[model samples]
Target: MFELIKKKLKHTDGYPYLLSILEHCLQMTYKRNGSQLQQWQLLDRILQQIVLQDEKGEDPDVTALENFNVKNIIKM
Candidate 1:
């Protein structure tokens, strides 16, 4: 799943689409595991990709939460 998302991130043009994908995946993760530590780890990985893409000037929306942490944004 992560691999597929990474691939999509690479090809995605709009930041909104990527953000939606991230939100959907995060919701799925929470539904599956109830916000476990592993879920945050997964979110971190996802955020890293967002940050990298944003750094490259690919997705501007990603920049909105470039410094995000699961604890700060996600309410368990």
Candidate 2:
């Protein structure tokens, strides 16, 4: 990775922002993991609802959360 970065810097007219790439990837990974964690939580909640349905007789909503905007999230 360091050698690739060095080669890119030498071959390009302008230097690529390595720190920016690193930062963006780090943030993107964090966001991806966060989304996965949220999904797991949602699944767990749904399963719990199913398990408790005999006692509580409640139905879980099949709809997803509505407030998350993809464009806004990507801008971050």
lDDT of 1 by residue, 1-76 (tens): 8677777676567656777867876676344555555566666767676667754568645554567676754566
lDDT of 2 at 68: 42
lDDT of 1 at 1: 88
Off by over 4 Å in 1: 1-16, 29-35, 49-76
Note the clash tally of each candidate. 0, 0
**Steric clash pairs (candidate 1):** none
> Using alpha carbons, what is the TM-score of model 2?
0.31
> Candidate 2 at residue 11, lDDT?
60
Model 1 gets an lDDT of 0.64
Q: In model 2, how large is the Cα lDDT of residue 50?
A: 66
Model 1 lDDT-worst window of ten: 29-38
Q: Roughly what TM-score does model 1 have, to 2 decimal places?
A: 0.28
